[model samples]
Target: MAGPKSGAYAIAAVPLLFIGTLLGFVIVGDEDSCVSTVAAGVSVTIDPGSVPQTEIAGYGHEQLVNAAHVIQAGKDEGLTVRDQTIGVMTAMGESSLRNIDYGDWETGGVINPDGSRTTSIGLFQQQDGWGTREERLDPYVTSTKFFQEMIQKVPDRDSLEPTIVAHRTQVNADPYHYERYWAPAVQIVEGLTGAQTGLGGASPAVCGGSLVPGEISAAGWALPNTGPVTSPYGPRIHPIYGTLRFHAGIDLAAGCDAPIWSIQDGVVVGRGFDRGGNGYIKIDHGAGIASRYLHMYDSGMFVNVGDKVTAGQQIGLEGSSGESTGCHLHFEVHINGDTVDPDLFMRQVGVPLG
Candidate 1:
């Protein structure tokens, strides 16, 4: 995710339409792209020191302060709360919400497409195509540059998933790389501002944060999906294999694109497609406990390899990807590396399967 780092809008006289519907916003840009903006006098401020906690989303005071700069940058661009959250999430994934004097070449060096070492630096990990080295090092400047790009690149971002919008803006290799930071970014934004935002309103059901939400048990467990269990975990004729085999997990039919929450906090140990091209996520929860979810489309996955996810945090959206015949989640619980009945295990942990 690298490019021009100029902070100014440079917005060429794009036409504007006054949307007098209850929310009253001025829509800027063309049909394919819409930038939601309030009246000129409306403004936002970010007080990093006002955050009650010294740490947020695993980041310390300095890092949260950097995120505040990002929020202010997005606000200055008149971006919605969701778009601002995307800005912060992108920075979190790229630079851990901190600015650095050097870039890709100095850290984990990588050759660019033209065979030159990557020049990615700053909060957005921008390349030389961005502004001067000094500009990229400035938080509000770099973040403003980022929001300007997002407004031009993302189409109808107000209706799209925040992670997808970030992916489109940054042009990252993995479309979902910014996903894990989403929940934390929402928390940081709301906590710092002390106001409920439109972050996840009308957005995809990602039970991470936003006006929507998630729930976890005191035992550190959560239901993957609150839908009905369509299939139990046990030995039976394989639905696709056509042979008598053990079904390693229980199947829950939660509608397509429904959020699939992680049942326990853990590191994502693995993710890959099955024979039918559907995807799966395996998390190791320690104490010999682990869980797996299957049948989501590749893009539906929210977290990635090595992402430390929390209980009830969204990990993926349900889909009929692999050998699946329809939309649902094939959820499995494991103990000591052996498959166990998820219904029984979750029930034991006070997170009974639906």
Candidate 2:
């Protein structure tokens, strides 16, 4: 298995959409292009601290605060702190990084302003018609796959063109296209979550204060009663989308109501449901890293938002909820919003996968 920096991985980029009559096109050969010149020419400036009043309208401040813990995991995984900025930027750009329920207006076979039918789908607006449906919607799977592909392109932090190419080949094919917007995107991520980039000259921290939600600490590894690890982090069959997305966390086959254990000591910052995340918990450990427990039994959640917890504590029971096939824990590790292998982080902390 290659580390996160290896970009040898190739997965489908989110298929493009016309959005409105604003779409323009160019024909390379026999194929009629449906890309917009405005999209091609326009530079996207992301103010990391500025939340779209129209977008993310319903989420409470606490909900956004809790989600930041998961974002910080990207940093812990050894990615540049900018990876967190880019990840959140990608989220904002892709699905506004929002876990949405409604489908594209053209979801079931509708045409775009360019007369092309919108077949691609989801929060990042990934398309199943272009890539496998299973790969598109799984967040960890898609995110890891995206990072793997992007890392191949980024020779260094300064050259993110390859990474952008891996994710949005059509819109980002020109190297300089996204350059103007990259800093803004980074600013948006850092500003929103209160995470420090440690990068010089970044805008002031907006949401200053970490909101790590559950208990996480360095200690001995006691596998949850959830059973043998059927799917360790990295590419796996996504139960919900029916495609291949990177599994950021481990999944163990277990019965519903099984006791879920905390790997370390921390605080509970988020717990709730709707789509995508289903039932989840986030634990924050100082040092800009955090752990996540997702898709568990809602009825069995022991802690709530803002509760502090210790190592090996019970935060929630395992179950099959929102976007899951069976009862299992979708475990994840994030440092600065970049997802890294939790297993690697675990071993570093003296806990073996065994």
Candidate 3:
């Protein structure tokens, strides 16, 4: 929730590999050639007026032009660069940045799959009710409509996940559908605007040197609790139940009343006691990634379900409030829906668990 002026946010030197081949771009001052570094320590330059077609590579000239309109609309509306990126990302998911006149239909725009012609159109594929056909087809008009609805639906627009904000506007069947385009959207936005949008929140001044415990991995994750992994994630005998069962989370031995920080920026989805009577908090970090912190002290949660939390922000105090035998923090990570090994997931992201 910290603003750029707070000095809490900084551009981490995280590689743009998530954006794939899009990283091989240079700033071109003229139409003839390109240059490597735009400024000292800054590899990309901001040319908001034009799209980096060479950088984006695969996108056609029309797609790039439509994307530029969306970005320009966000700027005209006085929205943040993050909001503009979300707009571009939504277009990517809805129509691949192309204004199509047909949807849910076979080739040649006939033979409906469900015996119907979907009126979804434009760069966002907005349905017929969204606007008139002429207006829907206009990039600026459609982008304005999308941004206006997004501003109305999302309270803290800048802090919410980009896909969540887009979903609120598009009302897509899959809320996470726009997630895959996020990294590319960000890269495009930065490549064209030169604004380094941090991970929706503040970054640690130094990876491991911040007052917050644990080092921030290159993938932008931090340990939820600063303690050794006492209970590894997997099948194990339940300490309290005295039966063998699948342990869904890894327990960090943090003793009583230890601070629990969020591993990444996300919206708090669930909080309170589970059926087993364990106090817990769940956060949706987008891209189908979610994290949960369990067995917190009865002081309840520091954040509500709808609140947005940044990485390393304390959300609760660790305790033995669940079916736990000792005070510790039980943390879990989920991709899509299936729970995965927390240690392996963390290590894969460049943060090793002790």
Ten contiguous residues minimizing lDDT sum, candidate 2: 1-10
**Can you rank all candidates by lDDT, best first?**
1, 3, 2
Best by lDDT: 1
Candidate 3 ranges beyond 4 A from true positions: 1-49, 106-116, 156-160, 200-354
Better candidate by TM-score, 1 or 2: 1
Q: What's the lDDT of the predicted structure labeled candidate 1?
A: 0.70
Report the lDDT of model 1 for residue 13: 27
Local accuracy by lDDT, each model: 0.70, 0.47, 0.66
How would you encode candidate 2's per-residue C-alpha lDDT over 201-257 as one tens digit per residue?
Answer: 211111122112333444544443345676788997786688998888877666675
lDDT of 3 by residue, 1-354 (tens): 000000022323443223322432222222122111122122222333456446463566667778778887876776765677788898888788888875533233432234555567788877666789999899989999888888887764432446666776776666667777877876666555554443222222222222334446667788888889998988999888889999998999877867788889899998655645577789999999999998764332456667887887777767776577777899999999989999998888777766
Q: Looking at candidate 2, what is the lDDT of residue 194?
A: 31
Going through the candidates in the order shown, the clash numbers are: 5, 41, 0
